[model samples]
Target: MQAPEFLAAHAAEAERAIAQVLDDRASVVPERLLEAMRYSLMAGGKRVRPALVRECYRACGGVDDARVLPAMMAIEAIHTYSLIHDDLPCMDDDDVRRGSPTCHRRFDEATAVLAADALQALAFELLASADIEAELRCELIRRLALAAGCQGMVGGQMMDMQAEDGSGIDLMQVERIHLHKTGALLCWCCEAGALLAGAGSDQLDACSRYGKAVGLLFQIADDILDATASSETLGKSAGKDAAQHKATYVSVLGLVPARELAAEMLELAIAAGSTLGEGGQPLNTLAQYIMGRDR
Candidate 1:
């Protein structure tokens, strides 16, 4: 199937699965927190991570089933939660997300913060509650927790916050921050997908490499978009990164070089996906789409 059609079909399914999971009641019974969780969880984005997970699963020869959907939804919930917290007053402080008002801006800051935190906890809860083998469930939960916690996205956010002043920052440092902040969850998505699909070590490693390359490629493209895209097209504030002096590929390597680097990474990602033969086409198209996206 063509990439666009394949992604469109599966992305719709993924959205429905995610909605079903998010609508389930949590054991804690906090209605307000649940509302906040649902608010951001359903806010909507490309749903790339979950799609990657499902693609990775298919690449590993796993049949799509209830189990796979839950895992995919769990990853997206974690990702959505991260975005909510990242947009808080203490973090990015942006007023818009996905072309709509940010969570903190729509609902007070306190509610947004609580929602982000609750969503994080809910992610693990869903993982643990998945109707899969206990060992597999534990593995997935542990991996996601690690990816979303200090060693991964959170650490990257801290680095971004500290680097905002643009003091003593370099290309290597910026890449390091992005690799952790953005790349970690992406890596986990592929890994979890492969694992759920019963992939062996070799396939898992290949998917991991592709995820890392694509993750960085996605960030570099975002930097490019920030530099060139209009707010109306981007659906969010453009030029915020440069305005805030955030360390980015464009900031360190310049626009031409940043675009070059993104292209290079896209090639690497495509090559990695090719290793999976026919099963990797979705991954290949995803890379191409990432590179070609205008916003």
Candidate 2:
């Protein structure tokens, strides 16, 4: 399949799996909280994280997607939870996300906050309860916690908030912030796939390298889009970074240079995946899609 078709296929499977997971929990979850969770969880985006998990597994010679379904579900839950919190008044304070009103705006701040918390817990729950072997499950949970917790995505977010003042910031600082904030979880996705597939060391190394490069590339692409794309195209407020004086690749390096950096990262990502031979085709395609995505 082509890139759009591949992404859409993976995204559809992810949503189906997500809905089943939510349905299984509907019996105990409060109606309002569940609704809030569903509003954002089901809200359509590229589902890139889940796709990464699935594709990386395939790249590692994993045949059955079902084997990694829980991992896919777990990663997306954490990703969506982050988005909900990120859109709160205390964070980006945006009213729109995925072309819909944000969780806090659609429901209420308390509901949004509670829903995000519940989803965070749910991510671990899914992994802990998966049918995978005990050792693998534990490893997945541990890695995910490290990725989503203070040492990873959360830390990067804190750095981003601190950098909003735009004082004494440089390109290295910007890269560091994004590596933790965006790159950590992405790296986890790749690692989770390889681990699930029981990939050899070489395949594992390639995925890790690809994930790191793509992580930075993804953020740089977002910076470019935020600078150039309209809110209609972006499905969120445009120029918020500039308005907020946030440090980004575009802010540190000029737009032209930022694009150059993204190109360099793209090559790195593709070359890393090349080590997998035919199994790496999907990964290369996905990296190209990330670089060229309009939103």
Candidate 3:
């Protein structure tokens, strides 16, 4: 299938799965918080992470078992939660996401925070409650916790925050921040997908390498978008990173250099996909799609 059609199909599947898991109409104990969670979760994006999981499983010759769906949902939930918190007044302080009002903007600050926390907890809960093998479930939980916690995304966020005050950050520092904050979860998505598909160490390593290259490329593309895209096209505040004085590739390296770097990373990602042989072509196509995405 073409990239657009493939993405559309996977995005639909992801939305269905998320709705099924989050459809607790039982009085809404958390009421506003639940609304906030739904608000952000349902707000449309590429659904790339969940699609990565599904694609990776397919690449590994795995069947579409029910057990894989929970992991996919949990990853997306975690990603949405991160976006919610990242848009808080204390974080990116944005008013928009996916062309809609941010969670904090739509709901109150407290509700947004509560929703993010709830989503984070729900991610772990889903992993624990899934009908997968006990050992596999445990490993998934551990990997996700590590990726989402201090050692990964949280740590990267801290680095970003610290660098926001005109702090001098080199290319390496910028890469590290993105690798931890963004790349880690992406890597987890690929690794977890392979694991769910019963892949061996070699396959897992290939996925990890693919994730690393694509993750960095994705961030580089974001920098380019911020530099060139309009808010209408981006579906969020463009130039917010520059406005915040965040250390980005375009900030440190010139826009031309940043674009070059992104191209290099994309090449690396495609090369990594080659290690998966024929089954990896979809991944290569995904890398190209991400690099060329208008939104």
lDDT of 2 by residue, 226-253 (tens): 9999999888999988999889899889
Instruction: Report, for every candidate in turn, its global Cα lDDT versus the true structure.
Output: 0.85, 0.92, 0.88
Pairs clashing within candidate 1: none
- Model 1 Cα lDDT, one tens digit per residue, 71-90: 77778778888898889887
Q: Which 10 successive residues of model 3 have the least lDDT summed?
A: 24-33
lDDT of 3 by residue, 169-270 (tens): 899999999999999999998888899999988888989999999999999999999989999998999988888888999998989999999999999999
For residue 144, give model 1's deviation from the true position in Å: 1.0
Q: Best lDDT goes to which candidate? A: 2
Write down the TM-score for model 2. 0.98
Worst 10 residues of 1 by lDDT: 1-10
| TM-scores of all predicted structures | 0.95, 0.98, 0.96
Instruction: lDDT winner between 2 and 3, please give it.
Output: 2
